[model samples]
Target: MNRLTLVHLTFLSVGKPPAAVEFSPGLTVIYGASDTGKSYIEESVDYMLGASELKSIPEDEGYSSILLGLRVDDGRTLTLCRALGSDTIEVFSGDLRDVPTQPAEATLKYRHHPKSKSNISRYLLNVMGIDGRRILQNSRGDVVPLNFRDLARLAIVNDTRMADKRSPVLGSWMPQNETKEKSVFKLLLSGQEEPVRPTAPSNLQKQVGKGKIDLIDQLLDETRERLSVEANQTQLRDQLGRLQATLANATAAAGQVAAERSAVVRRRRELEAADADTQQRASEVQQLLSRFDLLRQQYESDLARLQMVGEAGTILGYFQTGTCVFCGAEPQHQHPGHRLGESTQLAAAVAAETRKTTELHHDLISMIEDLESQAASLHEDHARHTEQLEGNDQELQTLDQRLEPLNTDTAELLETRSRLERELALHAQIDQLEDLKASLSAAPPAPPVAKADGIPAADIADFEQVMSQTLEAWQVPGDNRVTYDPTTAELAVDGRPRKSRGRGMRSVIHAAFAVSLARRNQARGFIHPGFVVLDSPVLTYRRPEDNKEEDELLAYDVVKNFYSDLLDNSAGQVIVIENGTPPKSVRDRAAVYAFSVDGSTRQGFFPPLDSSW
Candidate 1:
């Protein structure tokens, strides 16, 4: 099996100095304090291979490109350079540590594409003699092109994943990819790839059945999500019934109150109209009385003037008999008959006018009395109307006050009913979805195909033996009887699952798994990446702050044992990233890089901003 080894990783920029780190072919240990870019080294290596993106850290600012050096099994050195935020990789023929000044031998895409071979994944897989491999992705015997990322996860374990509860064979924690991850593991174990199977002619009925199944699965997922957050259906229905009854009673009471309010409002409006009319009539009557009083005064003045005129006529006829006052003649020239006749006629006319004037004045007084009577009657009517209007207003106000609580109750009940109805609707929808899913599940399933599945039992037993030997060599504190469970893809020690152990134990077990897998591959001549980068593999051995229970379990000198075992027995390049220092003897044997924060030693993968290096 051909294996490509990592030579170095470098970060370059335009004006800023390059940050770089070289790796040993056998064992390289980078142990440092926190926040000194120890984990970043592992991340950059993975990114250079096929990871989607590189994490952005403040310390990585001003760096525009990353260079990864690789040495093939044939002693041919190559460098892969990729710009920041770009998806293309530039492949150089030689091990140029810094950014390449000349053009690259080949340019490849960062991502793996099945139809195209000009990608970094295919290029690296070809170099390792494992290109064009296929793995079963699902139980339906569906196969997908085996991607480099599948193998990268097995080789590159980060700090966060070092102590994961899941089995190390299952790289991603996603449950949906269990089959595919298991297939990848089986591939690493057996060195066998799933062959391509031909598709049968499509049947209309089968197509429809499959489509229905797919839709039902989607609906089931959605329904489950909804039901996860909803209350009990029976309880919701009961609450809805109660709300409906309460709303009915509230609505009836509100209707009665509304009717009573409407009646009072109508009466108030009628009273208002009548009051207005009465006021208008009273005003008219008062004006009539005033005019009538003025007419009565004129009538009295006329009567007095008429009486005075009659008296003056009588005086002129008696005292001025010598002269004819009527014609302005002397008494001797005037005719006696003319004077006496004129005086008598004048007195008669005055007496008649006086009688007429007196009668008119009495009539006028009677009219004035009638008008005053009418005015008084209108004033009384207006007062009565005003009182009635006030009474109606008070009644309307009382009706409104009575209706307030009823209206409030009705509104609240309606809102509750609306909420209950919405819940009931959701319940109905869920019920429908469940029924549909059940019906779809009742459909006939596709016939199963017989193909190689799971790691062979003999192969598993061999791997388990190797796992036990590795743990014993490291002197892990336990009676280690390692057994691999294919069903769960987990390893167990003395009938106890690895996940049930502490974080420290889990980390150690995870490291043992990776190291053992590599060694097994090398020993049996299986295909592998020939390198493993573990971040914080011995976490609990040094960092007791993670868990006190882990500290208690890992009380032995496991760190020294761990480094010593890897130095002596590791099959390929093993890069260990940790927090604290390893044993001095082990450190002396391995290529060790120490990082610090107080300018004591090497700062990190990226040099300090103030440093002249």
Candidate 2:
């Protein structure tokens, strides 16, 4: 187990002398004569721990405040200080002074003032170790806002007042079980009360049962719907069969129609081919006739021109003086030779023209004759083409007539089948719906179970076992005086009768309980805030002050045994501030640390010097 030394401590009441001091392990005793500020040392520890309200010092006492310096086991130092004017508690490290809260450097450096941040509280109460704060709170009051659940989980605690306070053994577990009444004490500090559960009988289960039956019904209905679908399957197949039969008949009729149409088309095509041939011949004959007409017209014009021009013989015989067309006989020198030459030439030209014209006439006559014969043949072909075209037209009309009824029948049959299929599908769906309705009418029920308790058995063992070891270390022996009661939720202790037990016995029992609680704290083995600060206990020295030997010795024994218990718990600190420091016989066997408050101050007022302002 590790220990924490009070590096420094200072006490100040408002407008009074402040006290400053330091601490070490084993024992730290502040020896202050009458009017000395010895109690300031104890008060300083309290202020640092969590005594929130300011304690005022008298006018003569310099300052009314407190300051403390703690050196933790891991070498981290913390400074806790409070002054008269300060509205808040402050902490720091080294030269860094007047800190808002504990420094968060390390676990060793953790120094919590009364008004610490919530996270720091959680760290202390939930994570650091077992929490003493909640248990402390049970004895204390509403000092801060915190999570009590987390606090209780961290540690359990006992204070110097344990001996004076009543035991928690009776009715402690009453609040623990879900069985009975809850306790206010448990609620305030720990937020842990009696477990609770609904007392009402459930009606929702019946509704759920009915709902499940309905769901099953729905499922059955769906199955019946499936069966309906199966039933319709045969009808649909039969309808399909009928449709197939109708389709087969229609297909046969259509096939016959197609065959007849094909035959008609073939005959029509043959007729069309004949018509085309006749039309082509007629066109050729018409073209020949047109050419013959042009050629005859040219020949007639050429013959007319030939008739207008007389021959050379007519010119010689009918010369009659004008004469000499060959040579202007009378008016000019008429050359008979020239005339004869001209006549001969003219005669030859006339004969040539006459021959060409005669050949053209013969060609025209032959063409006209050929045109007449071809026209006669073309007229016959045209008559045949007209007859064939009329026949093809009638055949095409007949084919159209033959296929129309088959197309209509196919359309009507297909439409009727589609309608029947839609009706069957609707009927099948309705049948399924009816089955679903039946299943909803009949439902079933369910079974029951129980809940278990969940308090951790491991924690109970640790809390109980650790306290036992701590008690033994404190040298406080007993015959199974204390026992844990989960039902009542406390550790019950049976003490010897007050008069018969004597002061020694009572002190031993309570001191054992306190030490046990301190040791049981996991944080005490590692990091701790401070020593266990006990209030004044003077039950042993109740005899006359004048009886120096027996009374003095007995009083000495009380503090001596108390101090011895503290020394045994050397892993941490313990402060038992009692009235009247004890004498030699009890002191010889133990170690003691002494501190002096040199300042002159009155009782109930802060001291001057030896502390701080």
Candidate 3:
């Protein structure tokens, strides 16, 4: 097996100092604080190995080109140089650490092409003696030409991927990539590729299938045309649920408002009735007061007349035997039995009439007083009724104000629910039509391929043994009973799934998996890149807050043991990018680069800018 090892990586730009880092043939440790471009080194290496793009950072601003140095097992030192933002890599003959001054080497496209050997993927694979390989992409025996990226994903474990809950063999959680990823893993383990065998349906079957497919296509188009909404079925359902809840709330609120309005209206009616009755009573009291006043006035008038008569009789002196006061003649000339003798009787009658009229006047005054009191009471009642009515009117106005918006909200929610339901229905129809089309178009099932086609069960057991030994060597806190599940391509420790562990444990387990795979491949003489780059494999273990009892045990000396074990056992280059510092002894044994942010030591991969340079 031919393996390629990384030598160094360099960055160059005009009028700037070249930023570079060299790797050891054994273990290399890059450790430092965050934001110091430690992980950028890993990214740059992956970028040189045909990653889609290199992340842009502030430290990488002035750099215009990236250079990667690789030493083949056959003593050939090849340097790959790529310009910034360019999709092609320029390959040179020697281990050129600096920008090339001459240009007489092959240039290769970054992407892989099936018919072209000049691309970078094919070029690298050719160097590894694994070129022109094919692997099964699915159970149908459909094969795709092997690319270097399939191996690179396993070899280079970035910070974000190190703690991923997904299996290390899988690149992502995307369902479409599962079969291909599994096949790639099989290829790495067995060193044999699955041959391509194309399968086709019979003509008669194709004819029947085509007719059904055409009808399904038309139905699908119509269904899709009706699916005018932008949201998918799940989103539509979620929206409908939320809209229903909101509509229910709005309806309840509207009911409450209506109830409140009814109460206010009823109260207003009661207040109005009370106010009318009060007004009527007040009017009646006023009329009685007027009549009593008239009666009192008449009584006063009769009393005054009676008093005048008494005074007139007294002035005439008819009762005192005075001479002829009434007829302007002597009293002796008046007959004793004449009407003039009745003057005394007339005075007595006048006095008695005056007393009765005065009493009647007193009674009338009392009646007027009672009427005035009733009028005052009725006025108070009217005032209270008017105040209550005003209050009810204000409340009704407020409820009406609230009901307007509630009604509007309810209408909007209903409209939204209707729209969402329509979208959901359309989605279901499209799904059903697609399912029917699939059933009609599906070909006869291919002969069942052996589940363990490439990597056998014994190989999985061997791999699991390697992982258990690695964890045990690192003194990881577990029984170290490692098991590899081929179905999920995941490892379990002590009967617990790798994904069930905390982020810190997952990171450690993932690193152990990568290291174990590389070690196993090297031991078995399998085709591998001969080098692995791991970013932040021990980052979570450094944080005390994330530490558990198991993590605390892992943190004690796991970092030192991790570095020491790799240094002692790694057959090819193993680059570790982390934030936690290794032990002094391990640092002394391995090639260590430290990045600092406060100018204490080397600042970062990119050196400090000097105007003198």
Q: Which candidate is the best by lDDT?
A: 3
CA error at residue 572 for candidate 1, angstroms: 0.5
C-alpha lDDT values of all predictions: 0.81, 0.49, 0.82
RMSD in Å for model 3: 26.0
Cα lDDT, model 2, residue 572: 51
For model 3 the TM-score comes to 0.59
Q: After superposition, how far is residue 568 of candidate 1 from its true place, in Å?
A: 0.9
RMSD (Cα, Å) for all candidates, in order, is 19.4, 12.9, 26.0
lDDT of 3: 0.82
Judged by TM-score relative to the true structure, which candidate is superior, 1 or 2? Answer: 1
Give the higher-TM-score candidate: 2 or 3.
3
Candidate 2 wrong stretches, greater than 4 Å:
1-5, 12-16, 29-44, 50-64, 83-87, 95-160, 164-481, 493-508, 520-530, 537-559, 568-571, 583-605, 608-613
- lDDT by residue (1-613, candidate 2, tens digit) is 2334555565544544444444544444433232334444455455444444445444224554456666655566666555544544455665232333555343321234345443233333333333333221211111222342222211122223333333322212233322221122233222333333322224685577567667766665565544323436667768877997997899799888889878878887777787677678778877877887887888778766665554644577345455566455663565545555666666676678878988988977887788788778777877876777687678768877877988888888887677666657656565565555544343222222112212345545554565556544444446434545554344544434322344444444454544454455424342333344443333332221232334432334445555665565553555444334544432453332222322313332234245444
Better of 1 and 2 by lDDT: 1
Q: Across residues 1-613, which tens digit of lDDT does each residue of candidate 3 receive?
A: 5799999999998889889999998999987667778889999998998887987988888899999999998888899999877999999989897889878378998898879988899999998888977777665556888899889999999999999999998998887678788888888887778766654445686788888899889988988888767887778888788888888889998999889899889888888988998999899889888888888888888888888887787665544565565555565676765444556777888888888888888888888888898898999888888888888888888999989998888888888788788888888888998988888767556456533235787888888899899998888887999987777887799999998998888998999988998999999998788998999887643341321223333475777778878988874679999776666787678889977622236877888766346
Arranged by lDDT with the best first, the candidates are 3, 1, 2
Report the backbone clash tally of model 3.
1
Clashes in predicted model 2: 28
